[model samples]
Target: MVLEENKTSSKAPVGEFNSSDLEVGGVVVYRDRAEVKRMIRVSVKKGENDVVVNQLPSVVDPKSLRVEGEGDAIITDVIYQSKTNYDEKTKGDKKQYDKLQDEIKELVEKEKFLTFKLEVITKQRTILNKFAEQICKFSDSSKEEKADMSEILKSGSVDGVMGFLTAYQDKMSHLDEQWRMHDREKTTLTEQLNVLRKNAQDLNPTTVKDAKTNRCVCISLEAASDTDVVLALSYVVSNASWTPQYDLRVFSNDKTMKVFYYGLIKQSTGEDWLDAKLSLSTANPSIGGSVPELGVQLLKFKQPVVVSKSKRTSHRINYDELMLCSSAIGGGLQEYDPTIEDSCLEELEQKSTGKAIAPIEITTTQVETNWTSVAFNIPRMATIPSDNTEHKVTVTSVGLKPEFEYAIIPRMSSHTYLQAVVKNTSSYALLSGPANVFLDNNFVAKSSLKDVSPSEEFHCSLGVDPSIRLTTIPVKVLRGQSGLISKSVTVDYRHMFEVKNTKQEQVKVTLSEQLPLSTDERIKVHLNDPDVRKVNTPVNLPFGTVTLNSSNNLDWVVNIPTNTTQPITLTYSVEYPPGHVVQGLPKN
Candidate 1:
């Protein structure tokens, strides 16, 4: 990575000066910290040379700094120190910021003036309208040939009154036109002011310490002979990261789901990663080394740990401290533990920002992802700014065959839900992320995906399915009366469920219904039906054993053939002592 040739100047009595040979060549963005790799190209003379790379981020962890070169030179020491470049730039930007503030003030004052002008015009128009209405009334009453003389002479003769009204009418018309012009101008100015304000906000550095001074790492080299030195310096930087994003487009007709893998990258580490090669990973240098610690532990039963009921907000806001996993300069360790909480507050955060980012067309080579933690080597050079905007990037796309089914819980909801059960066939671990679901190219709603390992099957709701019709009705009503045999009351109830599948494909349905339970012996409830039809669940599954819950509820996982109607009946009866009404019995 040869940046440029070496040059020396005697203007500042330069014995050891900063070199312009260093350039940010690549960046490996992780869940938190980003590893910035810089290339230093220098032509070394046959002597000891001291050169510094002045374009390093201030958030660079001191322990994560590394420098190595391939030339006739031995790397001695690398030091990170403060300089005046960043401070000087900050001072220049402050002046521009002040100028922008003045512009905003001027715009605000102009808006106020224009608003007041519109108010005055409005008042004048109102007064003219009232006078015109009175004139109309006088004209209407004069047909009697005997109008009120006092009203007629209020503004002198009739001609005089007419001329006064006419002149004021023109005046009001002109004022209305002026108001329209002023309103347009005010709107334009307000928009301009808003854009400038947004620019001002984006231009300001995120951290005061980073903006204060230039933090550069300098290295001294002892050259054995004259040669061109190729050096690579890599350091860990904060305030820059990437998280997973996904788009699931379901082709209902084709019975397939297209999953688009995306990356939401934000860089606020002060320096722009312009035209730098990018590699997004789940690696984190903060957790620990790559080597696993093996220790013996005994498992014993104890009191369960009480987890907090509150959401883990730190997963969205805070990051763990960076601890370097570097054993040496060039040779380092990678410990991957992605710390991103992607799906929880994505909608809320997006609403707060008031900005929209269009989805990127996901594309990547087949070799981009691998086992365990996936790595995406971006093919093209990227220029990511430091405004903390979520820049979208393409990763990969996969088409999956999913089994679509309709599920109903009549006890809970009257609506039927469409669920897709798909296997995650890709090698990449699908970190939990917010997903936008589309059915046949029409956007359905916003949903989320759970963390699923490769080859694991997971299901997500795709919202209500209107094609499948379902209805639940009571066939037999609950009745209780005292019997002669034993002064007890008995009630019988039956609930019937009918499902009509309209789809062309054969679908499996899962329906759950509950029955009343009796904890006390005197208030026992018995099911009237002798036996219920057994479900043809998979042989590998142990769904044949039906154990009603202690709550007296049981789930029925049934399969409904395509283009057909299926009716299921659940019958039960409750009996209690006379004068002791059964509470679980339905009124119907």
Candidate 2:
């Protein structure tokens, strides 16, 4: 953001205002808004001096403005207003706008020429590739067709055909190189046009009937003597936010994990924060300050209310379309160019994970905790443009020793998933957000993290592991008649699950299963096999322990030895009177 200053007498015309040169000092970004602080030094006479801070972003909240400073002056009043002017540009601004327009025209023409050249090159390359393909198929054709297509075949012998292919490959390569060069030049031209257009737009912004509007803060104070006073102003602005993203790197050998916390900050507040101190907060100012109150409840007869449908037209511009226009005019985000190379993130996974790794430059943040929210203050200055794009910053990183285990629900899926349980040891709190999980420096899966305070434990799924195999056998059902007087029917159900651990180390696995719960009094359901008649109690088995809850859900925690196979069986029976039907009973 640029600021201009002009000094005038206190008795100047009513419409004219004295402005000060303000510089952005720092910013505190929250969930939906940011608090910006600006500072300025002003020389005031002994009498009353009105100082105006000009060129503040229009998105600022007028009610959130605050002014604080220490000097031998008595601060009286402060006012914030949206100022509008007609024909505000001077001769110099007009000259610069014309220059930018000329530059833009030149760049656009060059871009058009480059695009046309690239298209020609692409067509030539395609033709060359097709010719090479047809020439290679010449030898495979029959003699009758070869004689008919002899003119199409450039060479007679295999070696001659090979020579033609090699030459074609060279020509195609050269065409491809030329295409790339022209494409890069076109991209460069587009960027130059964007910059020039942005400059032109800044000089002549869109307004209502040629009127330019901006925000300014006015301060009224009385100085004891002629002196220079430093003024600090702060305000809240919207269209700024930060979201949390985490990278969890798991070291399989050490059974440890390192969490690289990052905050993706985005802002379109109409001012760039260049070399400004930035702090990210977890607070949401949009929710308001006071607590919500509940209204009195009333009940009455229901009545239908008729809603009239009326057609209304909106004058607001679509944001996506505006962004496209801005990109074309060099005032918005750049277009996606496929000619540019991708990031080096793919190099993280190679043939060998033991290769030498490059040291990453990591930035640390200072944690500031409060009763309502936690803030991460970046230690260094940052430059963030007002482009509304994601700017990732490293918040902090912590290493944790995690407990590993395998979990499976054979009824749902036969694949066993590896799980990691870790505690948040750092003082900072982990907010709920998306995370990327990497095992042994290779990306495994994308997961989400819940809100975890300091010293709180959390679980992360590390995806399926094939080494721990699980198999589900067909369920067995048996039915028979019992109770001679009533002739009741008894149905028996059995479930068998097999697990084989091929890993060299012993592993612990948790298997979950469920039993049917009876809702009627006459229909009785109970576990017959491996039944201890105890609910909410873990019964010890030879391989593991199984616990049954009131909901008829069973959880078995088993520790399997290396290279060993274990079989788990569960049986339950449902009994009902003759001629009575059970809806969910298993069939043989």
Candidate 3:
């Protein structure tokens, strides 16, 4: 019995079936070439009975089958238990799939509803467009009507249109208004979004980091020593996030108090850059206003200053020695150095400490003394005794200290007198007695003195002969045993002497003379033809030897020969016994 396997068109061999063609509950089989050929032939022979043929078993008796002609075949049963199981699973899957299909259909219906709503909205938009066109047409038709309509709309009035049209128009207007408001809201929201975006973009991390990475430092001058100066550095971070560290140093070229400040600052943010500033000030005191204008300029500082070295020199003067010499020259002496004291020396020391020092040696030089004299003439008529007689006169020096001399002379003025100060080196005062004074070999006057002190002074008036040829008055002083003594010393004192010559012609005469005379002896002379010559004779001649009984006149006579210009001389002697005590002249 050769049972043929039938193949259905839709259910042919399941060889390498794709998922699109394969179905659940189907069976597949692997077959050799001969079996496949045989199956195909059998399906062709019983096309209409393929189903029945497939149900029959395909058999060529295995024992009679040639191994060469037979090949192994893998059969897939389309209706076996596996097929049943696969069919049952497929049926269950179909039910679940149908449920899912129903859900998809519901979602499709909802999408159709939303599409219909979109279509309605489109139709409404068209209607609104038509209404807007009508409104534009009306507005264009008449300006007055358009203005009225615009005013009514602006006033929120909707009474102009008919009922349903009004309602639809109102709905449409409401929708339009809502759309416009929404658009405005959207525009505002968009603008805000743009601003936020811009702000976000502008936030640059690099720039912020750089700002936080830098700092500045400043150094200020504090103080200085001989070799180095101290400075204080203040570090300031521009950004608060940064703190800086600095390495500070001072540099200078000067050996004393010279310095410069330098430093580097690093940001605490670990940055690589720094900045700094430096300021300097001096420690010296400004000059005071007490100095003179020029002196202040001299003391002005032109550059930076360091320590100052004193350059002062000491100067000294001996007030005591100067006083002594000055007193000896008739200078008035007063107490000196009473104002200088220890306090003054201390002040001087303090002042000199900072000043330039200099060595000073002082030596004293004396001031010289000067003396001057002026004279006036005394007239012959002004003589003390009116009678013209030759007498020995004396004049005592006056008005000056001891050791000084003076001379009495006739002045040029009539009846005037002249006196002269004489230089003296002696330490004693001068004294004399009354004797005859002469001028031009003629008698002039007489002089005398009493007691006078060294510091005391006096004034005298002497006579001159108008007829005598005399330029000065000649006075005589008798040297006494008692001499003058000087009492005091002085510095630079002055004595004034005055002389007067009465005669018109210049008269020449011996100014002073010394004579020896007695205290009471009187000598007289016989004047032969005395009327031809004027005689200024002394009242008493203290030296002579003659008979007193002979009219108190002397036998000695001075003869005046006619027309002769010879001067006469007479000699007389006086004696004072020895062993007489004499007092020294008074100081003046």
Candidate 4:
């Protein structure tokens, strides 16, 4: 933001105040209002003096202004007001709107000329094409009407009609080239004209209006005998904000992943911040500051009402009662599971039962108050312009030991996705923000972060990997079953998954599969799990019931060794009364 200074005197000046050096100390950025802090050094004589600090954004709320005086100087009053001048420009910048309007007029005339030329070229090209098409019919038309081409050829004497036809062909080719040139010129002229029109859009009738110069903060001070004082001022202003971003990089040889945290700062606050120490906070200054007071409660009696006659269904699906786990598709199916879902994650106090992985360590200089919010203090000062452009600054970097896995849902997608799972082990909380994922120095995909606490684990997608392949096919199918007393019908489907790892290195994969859910007690569904312990060395095991969050789907974490192929099977059966039929089955 641009800044200017103004000083004024009233009556006989009893003291002279000097203030030249003003430094921006810190800035606490909120969602809407930012708390700006500035420190200025002052020296004054032994009597009353007038001091004014000018050049601030007009959006600053006067009620939120604050001032502090050090040393023996006692501040009598602080006032906020606007400052405007009669003329702010010389003759060169006097009629700014008139200048833009003149430029627009010149460009518009150029555009008209280009358009006319393009139309002429288009007409010429159309006529040439028509003549070329009729050239083939000249032999037939000449025999019925005038001199034929054969007669002209027999009596080739002086007229040179052959030269005329050749010249016409040459002219048509030249026009074809000229037509393309005119079209490009027209496109360029149109673009230039549009830019000029946009520039002159705000100037109606070619007149410029005077704008407010700036805002000022005036202070009346009294210093006791040549005292030096330090004054601090802070206020809230709009049009300034910052958002968090992350860059996560994983290496081929290293087990730990590196996370580079950043914040994108932007402002159109009418003034630029130059060489200022920036602090990003997750606080909103507009959320009211006053403490709440308790009030007395009173109760009243009323007549009872009647109930409606609508009974509930017995086969209703209570989605709320079904506490789904955290890994519910990872795409907005956020049914919160009261119980822990990952068999690798036991109780908070107990270690995981699966194969042990390394721990992640975070490093940063940040101040966190709650699990949902944190503030970052930038180590170095920066200069951000007031042009509403993004400027990214590194907040901190942390090293995370993430477990890599390939997750897939064969029914929904044929390709398997690589996922990196890790916990936020930093002392500070990680806010929700956009993240860029990278692997082995190559950019993978864009992801996002959510509210994660110190030890809360979150999933980050590493995009699709082509080395590992999977195929699913129906291996067994059975239909029609009957009994005498308890007559029933049954159908069984056995799905087989064939997987292969073509890469030279071993890969860890997690496959997510779903089973059909039965809402009625009479309808039953069953699953048969095949043992997959022979797949890997320390054999990936199913620690707990993977079908807790869902009645049908199961999750399997597998480690595929290099140049290895394996097959896994899961069977599900549906049974119902003999006379009943299912509605949503495949046509085949």
Best by TM-score: 2
lDDT of 1 at 34: 91
lDDT of 4 by residue, 405-461 (tens): 788788789898988899878765667888888787577888899967678899999
- In candidate 1, what are the lDDT values of residues 434-526, reduced to their tens digit? 888878766787888888878999887888987677888856876767667877777788888888888776667777677776778998677
Pairing residues by index, what is the TM-score of model 4?
0.59
Can you tell me which runs of candidate 1 are displaced by over 4 Å?
1-22, 83-212, 284-363, 366-372, 475-493, 514-553, 572-588
Error of 3 at 536 (Å): 99
**TM-score between candidate 3 and the true structure:** 0.16
Model 3 misplacement above 4 A:
1-90, 142-161, 164-169, 173-588
Worst 10 residues of 1 by lDDT: 317-326
Residue 361 in model 4: lDDT: 40
TM-score to native of every candidate shown: 0.56, 0.66, 0.16, 0.59
Model 3 deviation from the true structure expressed as Cα RMSD, one decimal place: 65.3
Question: Which residue pairs overlap in candidate 1's backbone?
Answer: none
Q: Give the alpha carbon lDDT tens digit for every residue of 218-282 in model 2.
A: 67778889888777788888999999888888988768898888778899988888788889998
Displacement of residue 387 (Cα, Å) in model 3 is 99
Each prediction's Cα lDDT score?
A: 0.67, 0.75, 0.26, 0.64
Cα RMSD, model 2: 21.3
Which candidate tops lDDT?
2
